[model samples]
Target: MAIAKTSPSIKYSFPPFVPDGARLIILGTLPGEESLRLQQYYAHPRNHFWPLIAALAGKRMPSSFAGRVALLQGNRWALWDVLEGAERIGSSDAAIRNPTPNAFGKFFSKYPDITSVAFNGQKAHDLFRRYVIKPGIVANDRLTAIDLPSSSPLHTIPFEEKLAVWHDRLAPYLPPKPQNRRAK
Candidate 1:
């Protein structure tokens, strides 16, 4: 009798939070286990994603799923992962294999206004460039890619540093900050 070996299966990512009139798209590699289990992006309490985003946008961290979505949509920024599916272990990008990139063709067709893509980390940027940009599928003369520090607790870089870069890099595409209107 021979023993059988099984290969690891690829896990698929959730639907993107792309909205119409979006100018910037923030791309991550893939959601971690906690995020997948919670059916939310960056659901881990230790993850700095929400805090960084809120600080950059000059808004409070969203405490609810709907609030998070609203924050991104309101800023005309989109959120998605570069890889739609991959065989990864323990939520580490280094463990990822057999990656399948997201459908950028359809996504770009729907959100033609998107001017730039900001990658959350090197893995996301590399994957997108190798799978989509280099292939000429999503890359174009008008569209640019920016690499930002990962907000994952795994990344170890300070949140303030990441937030500064994110704010500066994305400022041009972001809408003007809202002002508090007061009436007598």
Candidate 2:
């Protein structure tokens, strides 16, 4: 009798956080173990994603999940994953298999104002280029892909360096500094 090999379970990505008037959509490969457990994107404590967003927007980092979501949405930013689901025993993108991309065609149609698709890392960018560029899926005339440094602690680039890279490439799409409102 031969012993059978078992494959990893299929992990599903979280629903997108596309808000009204969203102009930019940030895509990660998929949420990691911690994120999945927390049911939030980039939930890992060491992840630099929230800090980067706060720094870029010139705002204090929001601590609560709802507050964080509001911060990004208020800035006209959306968040999602490149792969809707993938089979992987671990959180490593390299180990991902049987990947299925999100519904870009319908998403693009519904959210026609989105001008930029920002990938959180090289893997996410590559996957988008490979799977999300189907006919009528992306409005090429309006959509531009922006490569962003990964906020994962596993990524080698330093936090400050990553900030610089994102500031350089994504300055236009990132949320601008909030205006101060004086009491009337």
Clashes of each: 0, 0
Instruction: Provide TM-scores for the models.
Output: 0.89, 0.88
Q: Assess the local accuracy of residue 129 in candidate 2 as a C-alpha lDDT between 0 and 100.
A: 77
For residues 51-127, could you state the per-residue lDDT of candidate 2 as single tens digits?
98888777799999887787787778999998999999878898899899999888888888887899999999888
63-169: candidate 1 lDDT, tens digit per residue: 99888788788788899999899997778889899999999988888888887999999989899889988888875676788889888899998888888888888
RMSD of each: 3.1, 3.2
In angstroms, give how far residue 128 of model 2 lies from its true place.
0.6
